[model samples]
Target: MSMNKEGRPTAAGAVTAIRTAALLPDEPLLFEIGDREHSGVDLPEVEIGEDRLGGFGRRTSLDLAGLTEPEAMRHYVRLSRLNMSIDAGMYPLGSCTMKHNPRLNERMARLPGFADVHPLQPVSTVQGALAVMQQLSDWLMTLTNTAAVALSPKAGAHGELLGMMAIKAAQEARGEGHRRVVLVPESAHGTNPATAAFLGYSVRSIDARADGTVDVEAVKAALGPDVAGIMLTNPNTCGLFEPQVIEIADAVHAAGGFFYCDGANFNAIMGVVRPGDLGIDAMHINLHKTFSTPHGGGGPGAGPVVLSEALAPFAPLPFLRRNGDGLELVEHVEGEALGRITAFHGQMGMYVRALTYMLSHGGDGLAQAAKDAVLNANYIKARLEGTFSAPFGGQPCMHEVLFDDSFLEGTGVTTLDFAKALIDEGFHPMTMYFPLVVHGAMLIEPTESESLQTLDRFCDVMLELASAARAGDAERFTAAPHAAPRRRLDETRAARQPVLKWEEAEGRAEAAE
Candidate 1:
């Protein structure tokens, strides 16, 4: 048995040997495993009344397949085992904070009163639910030092649009309808520009300085009467905080414009700094990221936008307010308000999970969590600095570390290749080629959930990979992810010509035949 760099048997080598010994079975599709004749259950047919159907009833038998109970269970169980979740191991995705989801939060959300209540239920009947939402709103407003919050936005991008709409409404109320441009930093989240453009504002890009933070001088140059506002990400996509944020916000306000802070990276500053104090007019707080709700997979997310006193009155409709006896929802557009955004109140299940996280962490614990997240990221950066090249070196990052692929030069290992190799190391790859400002960016956010021992193991694997690349072992990087269920794919082609549905694939196969 050949020894690894640590003079011990490598787990990768062992895994390869196991694969060679007994190849794992490929997980077939659900349709492939399903049988036409198999039925896990038998139910007596019930005749539908004409009054119940109202002439819309189907006459033909439904086309449905069946599987045994054991088969159904096994199919899903195997699929679940293939997924890489926060519960499984460390998720180092930057910008997208994939921190551990506490079981306590899950338990609290599963409570019958919170989970089973319908949106159309009477306010009097669901008084406890309304109280929970109101308390959560109070916590958000208090933490951000903002005047009011619109909790109807569904996700981060959705929240961005909501805040912008409020800003636009406030501006129009002041007769500043000529403001039609939005300033976005080059390092802002991808959704910032999209959200602004979606709201009919022309987006202008603001350049970042060499240190990876937005320059106040650049903001000054972009300021004009036509400027609507600026969408900025603090502790930005580069993982560095914009020290000149206050000056930027002030300049925008002076230019007869508003400020929209993208709260995607709020996980790093919650309980540390409030955006309102930095002159922010409106900012969205991503409950999924900062408050530790289930994130990604087109999630049930909550991104409540906290507005300053200047913009609070223009908040979206369908907001909660205190009545004489209990809570009340304002569903219609009132004095200078933007209209409702959603059919119902925002994601209730996500709100419950987020509130549980906040209450469990409290004030001091939440602050400590932010500190720990920054510490963990800096630890990773310090460990791998000599082996990798950080775009913005010699600066203390807020929560995540940003690296460029300069060290991988002449190694024949592209960013995609290196990322794929990480699968063999039993870790999910960090966000790659993002922020778009740096060349081949690798953004890693090892949230506070991971312990030092786990961090060290991850670092060790990364170092080994870097060393192999430097020593001219091209195959180690190029022919990567040897142990993954799937091999390297032509990502470029997949993006350009995607088969969006199974029927599309069938059509292509028929054409090929």
Candidate 2:
């Protein structure tokens, strides 16, 4: 073994250092692990009668391969160790709110009553599940001080579409269908503008002031008879709260336009501030982020949209109702509701988890979680302020901290390079080049779940990396993660021309020959 300057073992004479050596040999693809003749299990052959056979019957052998029970178990366990998750270490992805998912929530979601109940079951059979949905809805509405909630949108972006559709429906009801423009702040979530455009509304860009919050005057100037509404994210993407939110909301309402608040950042102000009281007509709460459900990785997530009385009348249907008999779904748009958004009720498992989180914490506990999240973010900002450049320096951030790469100028190290280097330090990288308002953006959201010990360790690693960059040690960042299973990839080519499907190595070898 050869040691580098840091006394870490190096692979051969390469300048790069390997952090941790793999315990097992390099894992092969599943297809490569098993033979075509192998079968993992014994099964009885099925005999198809000519009368029962159809054109779908296979005439040739299938392409499936099999592994033994032990081999299959080991294969997955090794692959899992190669991936990063919230369980492995701290996930500091900003704006996405990749917080810890409580085991208690998972335990409750796995209960047979909650997990086994199908959406197509009889109403009376799944009364408990229906009650859970109603309870979750009530909790969300109470937290936001809104009149009603539609617990059917699949995720945050889906919830935005639902809210915008409600706004459009209300406008058309009042014969304002010509209000075709929606004002979105440049600092708003990327989904805000996409949702507006998807709803056939022209999106007008509202500029953010130097402080990273939307300017009230810019919003007023954009409001007109043709303006449908404004989609604003409170505690906006810069990790700073919109100070002029009330003024902007009042202006939009005064101009006969609704307010669609993107509730993606509700984790920072769950009990601290209510959007409804701020004159917001509609908002969507991401259960995965605010409440403690598993998020991302093709999630089974939920984004319930809470509506004000002005917009509640136009909310989507298939909502829960309490008749004289028991809790039942109003499967039709009986009253002033717009049509249904999803075919079935929303994600029941996510609903159970969110409600479990709420009941376990209660109102006061939820408020403290919000406070702690803000405190954690501010703690990070205070520690890394001098080493990194903060775009909005004077104010306290809500639940995340935003840093620009101005400090890295002339260091010959880019933001992407720095992020990749963090992987070699045995930690996941903070979100980079996001929220687009600032140049070379690096956003870090340390949710309230992390302890001081973990945070300090993470901060120390970041400071060390910063010092290396300033000292002109470009190799440390440029050739990073030599310990990982693979090395840096050509990101531009990967994004522009992705090979979505798997191709066998043997086919490639034959083609080359």
Candidate 3:
């Protein structure tokens, strides 16, 4: 076998490893597999061949990637071995809570009641699903201390947009439609300003104090009659709680603008702090992050937005409601609604899994879960302080710890290089070059699910990497992930001139073949 220039493995020569390879044969497309005289399965002859359309087009030839069923199965099994998942081991991607997706949650999601329900089913037929929504809603309301929940926004970014839309709607309703500027912190998630911009509002950057919290003075100066609101990530991206969150919210409210909280970091303060209580007008809870549902790689995710009383009336529709005898879904009719973000009640499977997780861990358990999450992050920070450079000197971190690349000053290793090395150690790299306020930011979020032993092992690897960097072995960091299926990539070139599809490279492959 050979590897592409980008280091993607090729299956040109060697067979893919699979236990039952003897039962399977590799695919040889179209002309090699199908014959005019042979068939794999026989079908009863039709009395009349139906023509769905006048013959504007008809198949002249069949082009298929042909393989026997067993071949296909084996091929997939071999491919699965090359992948890494949360099930494999610890995934320390900060901001992204790639924690365990317990089998119990999967089991409940697969139950026929939820798995088999159709969107067009009558209201009476799906009472159980509606009840689940209501139950989830109750938990969200109690957890965030919000007046209403909009269970339609699809993911974290989508939820951010939804919350902003509600804020916009409430503002417009109050004759403040000219409020067109949004203040986003320098350390906020990238999605915060993107959400505002998508809704046609001008985005203004807010500054962070030396302590890593949003500067209340900077926010105050940014507020005016034309300002719509502020998109703040409390337990801000640096993984430090915004001690001035209430004062910031009050500033926004005093300036006649709604406060929109980016609740992506809700995993850190889930049970401990309520966005509503902090005077947030609206916020979105990432179900995958806070409730422990699996996300990333183009997800099966849910980001339900929680609304304060002012914005609740303007929330998007297709929400669940219970009547006297039957459960009814309150969907906006045609020509209604500010907008319909997603169709037909969002992702039901994610809803089931998130609610299952919430139920298994009751309110108090969820609270303790958040506490443990903060504790784990602090543990990492405390243990690695001597080895790495933590930007915000010495305060207890929230759900994640942020370190700058300054510690590697004379070491000659960049954050990217260090992260690539982690892959070689059979561990996923922490989030790097994010929360742009920090130079070469390395954010590590060890969700509460990890045990102390696991944390210690991760710390050991990190310490070793730091020591190696200090030892001036720049080569070690540059060419990393050697033990994994792939190695370090030219990420800059990959991003700039991406080979988006395999078809684009097929001509070169065909020439070689």
By TM-score, the candidates rank as 2, 1, 3
Q: Candidate 1's C-alpha lDDT?
A: 0.85
Candidate 2: list runs displaced more than 4 Å: 1-21, 35-51, 68-71, 297-299, 335-337, 505-513
Give each model's whole-structure lDDT. Answer: 0.85, 0.86, 0.82
List CA RMSD, all candidates: 8.5, 7.7, 6.0
Worst 10 residues of 1 by lDDT: 12-21
Of 1 and 3, the candidate ahead on TM-score is 1
Off by over 4 Å in 3: 1-53, 60-62, 297-299, 333-339, 504-513
lDDT of 2: 0.86
| Model 1 per-residue lDDT tens digits across residues 1-513 | 222333442222111111222434455555455433433454445885555676697896443435545556776777677677888888898888888889898899889999899999988888888888898998898888899998889988899999999899888989998899999999999999999999899999998899999999999999999999999999799998899999999999888889899888888988999888998888888888889898875258889999999998888878787899999876866464667788889899888898899899998888899999999999999999999999899988889999999999998888878888888888989999998999999999999989999999989988998988888988977888888777777789999999775453574354345
User: Model 2 over residues 1-513: C-alpha lDDT tens digits?
Assistant: 233344443323212112335573456655565544535653446886575455777788665545555556777887778888888898888987878899999899999999899989999999999999989888898899999999999999999999999999888889999999999999899999999999999999988899999999999999999999999999899999888899999999999999999999999998889888898999999999989899765258799999999988888888889978689998876565478889898899999999999999999999999999999999999999989999999899999999999999999999999999989887788889988999999999999989999889889999999999999999989988666776787899999998775466763453345
TM-score of each: 0.90, 0.91, 0.89
Which should have the higher TM-score, number 2 or number 3? 2
What does candidate 1 score on TM? 0.90
Q: Write one digit per residue (lDDT tens) for candidate 3, span 264-382.
A: 88989888888889998888888888887778652477899999998888878877776887678887656443656787888888888889998898888888999998899999999
